[model samples]
Target: MEFRQVSDLNFNISRVTLGTWAIGGWMWGGSDDQLAVGTVIEALEKGITTIDTAPVYGFGKSEKLVGQALQEFGNRDEIQLATKFGLEWDDEGNVQRNSTRERILKEVDDSLRRLQTDYIDIYQVHWPDLDTDFSETAETLQELLDSGKIRAIGVSNFSPEQMDEFQQTAPIHVCQPPYNLFERGIEKDVIPYCKENGITLLTYGALCRGLLSGKMSKDRTFNKGDMRRDADPKFQGETFDKHLEAVEKLKEYADKNFDKKVIHLAVRWILDKGIDSAIWGARKPEQVTFDNAFGWKFSHKQVKGVEEIVETIVEDPVSPAFMAPPE
Candidate 1:
């Protein structure tokens, strides 16, 4: 329920952004339209006003559902819509990166129509398209900003070097990267880069695909088509067991120290590390709980303590590298 401001656009985004990737039903088996709308409403009612989605999410289904929810909510101005472009999928659902100028131009209008909004609060490139020149893509986003089609520009899964090249051509107001208690890769560069450059960090995967939810069990199973079954390395064998054990210790620590759960600790850890916002992915309405995570502060010592506990259990932790787009 807490909010943070982006210096560039003065946008007050909620600490918990409603991530609609699962609602898109692209990789997490499937989705229910009714449940999806209810999920958005639940998030908004719980003070999560920002929604992060993408065109390739169910190939526009997520955006359409979000548009429906907005219409039902009846106050478009209250919500901050954050969506992405630069990835295209085929009839068979194969995805590839494509950030050419023409692609961006086409994608924006489609996004507008799907979301039923003329202006997007924040528009981001889903991934870096090596085939396209960074300057060219930057120019296109700048044009969108100048034309009022998009209020701000951001990029996801981009390195510091890529961001430097992107900023040389256009201003970046935010950066989205995969970050959580388990995946600490961004701590090496992306976090510091955004912190120093005045760009807000909207980190996704705050739950580590339900691993940190404190509800996953050793006997749990995933849907046959679920991305966690194949795409995520953390869900495999010994790594999964190690992660679960770490979560158990984390839960105990949270309950003893702060009367919180592992999920709250996972999210608060990110916010405490200076991230502007964290995207919480969910498909069901009841799953959009934001109150428990906000208004809690983690001491530097406590943060270090949690890290040490995780280090003890997860000696060979893995990042969500499989979620990356094909090169």
Candidate 2:
């Protein structure tokens, strides 16, 4: 469990953060509370000190469960709690971007209550609200930081220009972008911007929502409520097959070269690309295995070889455009 210090933060966060989006059970069908609790405990035991969650994830259910697990673990100060706001949802699960000053103020209090923590280690804007002024959101976060409601401010799914605009009013210590073996969209601008600005990048979807986990199969089916069933185009028809083919080749390469699974390779790939941290999504205790993901990396030549393999296998690669919030 290697740790990296983010700008102006008190704790050195783990390289691998436990992502609770799946445990939220909103898009992945459903989740069991006991299983979620066990998964978090397993993560802490395995040296995962940072947990990334969002208010819209299962409509606060994920944060509540994480709070419960942290209470049982009884080590609030040792763990880094990373959560987000701005994405609002109603009873019908209709979501929209809302990052007004009032919304940010209200959401911080709600997140505190849900997470069972007075000060969030890092609080982020879940998405860019086109309707709201960036300064408005930045000023609100600055106020939160000044009042000690949050230790640091971060942003997710934001472009370099958007971040530049927001930074005029407040500081951004970190950036959360969806990054994985399949989702390389952020590498062009987001990654370079964070690197140049000294903002830590905590990338989510290390396994591409289980596609690179080496467990996906052609015949495997998703439940009705599962986001992969409809929301994710990677799991649909030919794109799914193309991704699976790439995963198969990547898995073979991993096993042959390093005696590691594709999941490990997927995670290591993110880290090797100079990301500050990779968020691993898990819903069960056994799924929290961190041994396979650490202690090794792909060589430069091997990295290019892996890219060649992906190019050879995935003819029509798809972006995760469907997961973006409403404008």
Work out the TM-score per prediction. Answer: 0.98, 0.98
Instruction: Write one digit per residue (lDDT tens) for candidate 1, span 1-327.
Output: 788886477668988899999999988988899999999988888888899999998999999999999988877887899999999989999999999999999999999999999999999999999999999999999999999999899999999999999999999998999999889999999988998999999999999989999999888888877998867888888888899999999999999999998888999988999899999999999887767997779999999999999889999768777888796
Q: Worst lDDT window (10 residues) for model 1?
A: 2-11
What is the clash tally of candidate 1? 0
lDDT of candidate 1 at residue 17, scale 0 to 100: 93
lDDT by residue for model 2 (166-247), tens:
9999999999989987878898899889989989999998989899889999998998799899789899898898898899
List the global CA lDDT of all models: 0.91, 0.91
Off by over 4 Å in 2: none
